[model samples]
Target: MNVLLLNPDALRGSDPAYPLGLAHIATAAMKAGHAAEGVDLFSENCPETAIFSTIESFQPDVVGLSVRNIDNQCMRAPIFYLETAKNLVHTVRKRFYGPIVVGGAGYSIFPREALDYLRADYGIQGEGERAFVMLLEALEANSKAFSFPGLTRRTADRVEWIPNVPLASLEGVWADRSLFPPLPYLDAGTRQFPVNIQTRRGCPMECIYCTNPWLEGKTMRFRGPEDVVLEIRSLSDNFGIARLTFVDSLFNHPTSYTETLVDAFLKARLELSWECTYNPRFHDPHLLSKMHDAGCVRVSIGNESGSNLSLTALKKGFEREHIERSVLDAKALGLETVCFLLIGAPGETKDTVLESVCFLDELNPSSVVVTLGIRLYPGLELSSIAAKEGMIDPRQSLLSPAFYLPRELEGWAESFFLDEVLPSHPNWTV
Candidate 1:
């Protein structure tokens, strides 16, 4: 079987993320005695023409499209990414008569809706390494037994979804970097783009608007510290990659594992600069100092809101004081700190927004990112709140981008951020 993996994400941003998930699936397919190829549309100048050309050239028996995001997550000017994905699927269908399977972080959230909207043959909801291989085997044998974790298929009447099960360990699992070359992604822009590496999976934190717990299960899984260090060394020696970004949900959680990983980096003596997102609840000065010493040049704090009222409503698990201490600690160690402020969540008001602005102003990190509204997905507490408040229909499909912003702050939030908050904070960006 010839398997072609396509990355349909073309979202413009500061960096072009290498499709690590697709590469993993491709690698799994190859190891299962199948010919696998990967094409990334993000680096292409014309994705439509490129999709047609790739189908003509590869003539794959099966096509797997990885959907990374549903929208830009910006409420002020939301770009629905699914339209591009659907068009890509249409192009593939026109050129090739093969199974089209969709999966990724974005598709996993709304499996049925995304599969129906994209009009794909099947969809894999969660981690695809194992499930994808099983799917390939089934397709090859022409077997109807499609029972597997995270597999979604369209029946004659309705779409059926099997719940996803998180992998218990990441011991021998590794992504095949050869599928997607590093130079094209690295040299896409003038700003240095870091290669991403995931040291762990799963998130236990229950933030109201977050989809991490849904995409990845609540259990925490860590790769071996030595294995992660070896991968970093390979990136440096083989690819000449110096910068890295750890894509873990919470890099510093379970402080013991983080300390061990840092120690392994020190022992390896690899010269690489890296950054990761940190949870303020696990703020520790000593561990942070060790991380800085271990080639961590920057840290991004996931402080959604600096006001206690909004923080509690979001179930952030930490308070404003924790954010302050984390930012100050990272700053003291000369680590570039970036703080995130998600405005217009539930319980957000004039006073709470002002409190957040004032708190961030006093802290003064290296940079601040402010978002106006929270993207609502189904089965979230915020979605229920939005429905109860008559903000959205309870039965509405969120495949199209829908945001949850308080009515009280609708006209006022955008103006306030533009006039008062953004004008004063030179380091902040919306």
Candidate 2:
């Protein structure tokens, strides 16, 4: 089977990501004795004609387009990426007869809505490692793939989803970091092409503002340290990969995982610089030291709110002290950090918003990304709160891109961050 993997992601919502999940699927399909090829719409400036040409040239038997993001992750703005996605789907619908399937992190979150919106024949949710290869096998046999794990299908009447897949063991597919294209660095102006290697999956923290607990099922699992080091070095040697972004929901989960992995990378002397997100609850001084020794340059901390009132409302287990200490420790150890501030969650008030500003004032990191809106997605604690407060439409699906700020707060929350929270830091922008 000739497989066409499309990474339809933009620079804002998603990085020029290496299409990690797509590559895994392509590799799996190829390993299963099928010819696989990939196309990334991220770097391309051309539109339909170019993609059509590429598809025409390749003439794939099956097409898999990876939708990495739904919105700009701000203002529910329909990203340009979606228009590109819809155009590709419609173009493929008219020109081609092969099956069109969708997969990726953002696609998994709203698989049914996205499939319906894009009018795709099928979609896969959760992990794509198993379902993608299985879909390929089914396509080769010219049979239905409805029974494939983590698959979703839309019929004339409604959208149907299969059972969620179990956590795939990372033994075979810990993300072949060699396949990723060169990506532009966010902080550094330098051009870097490194393969992304996700060492762990799923976070145990149950922040009310988060959907990870529901999406990832609160399981914190890490691949073996030796396996991770081997993959990183191979990627570096084969592809000249120098940087890595540990795509773990919370890379520092289980604390010991970070310590062990950091020690391994240092001892191996891989000379690889990696960035990741860390859980705020952990502020171990010793672990922070290990991170610096291991060549970790930056870590993103999800300090969702600066106010204790907001923190309590969001059910984030850690308080302001935990956040403060973690930032201090990371800075002390010479590790750069990016702080994430999510304002205007449910039960947000003026006082709580101020608390958040104060928190930001105190713990100014190297950089900060301020998010003005929140998602009222189904199965999340925030979704329930939105329902209780009548902030969301009862008929709309959570994936329909609803913004959950209180009606009273309106633009106040957005402007407050701009006027107050952001300017305090030397290098901050919304």
CA-lDDT, candidates in order: 0.88, 0.74
Candidate 1 TM-score versus the reference = 0.97
Off by over 4 Å in 1: 188-191
lDDT by residue for model 2 (150-186), tens: 8888889898888566565666665543334544323
Best model number under lDDT: 1
Ten consecutive residues with minimal summed lDDT in candidate 1?
184-193
Candidate 2, residue 244: the lDDT equals 84
Clashing pairs in 2: 182-193, 306-356
lDDT of 2: 0.74
Provide the lowest-lDDT 10-residue window in model 2: 178-187
Tens digit of per-residue lDDT, candidate 1, span 196-278: 98899989999999999888889999899988988888777778888899999999998999999999999999788999998
lDDT of 1: 0.88
